[model samples]
Target: MEDETMSNTSEKIAENVLLLAVARLSMALSLPALGFVAYLLNLNLEQKFQAQENKIVAQKESSDRQANLTTARVETVERVAQSAIDQAGKVNERLISVETKQTQESAASERFQAATLTRLDRLQDSIVGQSNAISALTATLQADQDRNRPPPP
Candidate 1:
C-alpha cells in the first residue's frame, strides 16, 4: 500500500507540468497574431491618408482654374473700358474743332457787315450834294426866261 500511494503522487505531478506547458505555448502564439493584426491596421490608415492627399490636390487645381478664368474676364473688361475712353477723347477733339470753326466764321461775318455800313454812309453824303447843285441851277434858268419876255407889256 505504501508503493501505491507514491505512484499516484508522481502521476499528479506529471499532469500539472503538462497543463502548465500547454498554457505557456498558447500565450506565445497569441503574441505573433496580435502583431499581424496591428500591421494590417497600419496599412489601412496609410491608404486613407493617401486618398485624402489626392483629394486636396484636386481641389487646389480646381481653385487655380477658377482664378485664371476670373483674371481673363477682368482683363477683357478693362480693355473694353479703355477703348470706350479713347473714343470719348476723339469725340471731344472733334467738338472743339467745330466750335473753333464756328467762332472764326462769326468773326468774318461781323467784319463784312461793318464794311458794308461804312460804304452806305459815304453813298448818302454824295446824294445830298447832288440834290443841292440841281436846285440852284433850276432857279437861275427861271430868272433868265422872265427877263427875256418883258417887251410883251
Candidate 2:
C-alpha cells in the first residue's frame, strides 16, 4: 500500500508540471502573433490612405484643366464679339460718308442746271433783236431803189 501511494503522488505531480509548461509556451507564442496581426492591419490602412490621396490628386488636376479650358473659351467668345462690334462701327461710318457725298453731288447738279437755263434765256433774247434789225434794213433798201429808177413809156 505504501508503494502504490508513492507512485500515484509522483504521477499527479508530473501531470500538473506538463500542463503548466504548455500554458507558458502558448502565452509566449500568442504575444508575437498578436503583434504580427497589428502590423499587418497598419500596413493595409496605410495602403488604403495612399490610394485615396492619389485619387484626390487626379481629380484636382482634372478640375484645373477643365477650368482652364472654360476660361479660354470665354476669352475667345469675348474677342469675337468685340471684333464684330468694331466692324459694325466701321461700316456705319463708311455709310455716313457715302450719304454725305451723295447729298453734296445732288446740290452741285442743281446749281449747274440753274446756271445753264439762265444763259439759254439771254441767248434767245439777243437772237430776236437781231431779226427785227434785219427786217428794217431790207425795207429801207427797197424804197431807195424805187426812187433811183427812170420812168418808162
What C-alpha lDDT do the candidate models reach, one value each?
A: 0.55, 0.57
In candidate 2, which residue ranges exceed 4 Å CA deviation? 1-3, 82-153
- Clashes (candidate 1): 0
What residue pairs clash in candidate 2, if any at all?
Answer: none
Residues 36-138, candidate 1: write the lDDT tens digits.
6545655664575466556555655655565565556555555776775665555556555655655565565557556645654565465445544544554
TM-score of 1: 0.41
lDDT of 2 by residue, 99-131 (tens): 565556556555755664565456556545654
lDDT of 1: 0.55
Clashing pairs in 1: none
Q: Estimate each model's TM-score.
A: 0.41, 0.45
Q: CA shift at 5, candidate 1, in angstroms?
A: 6.1
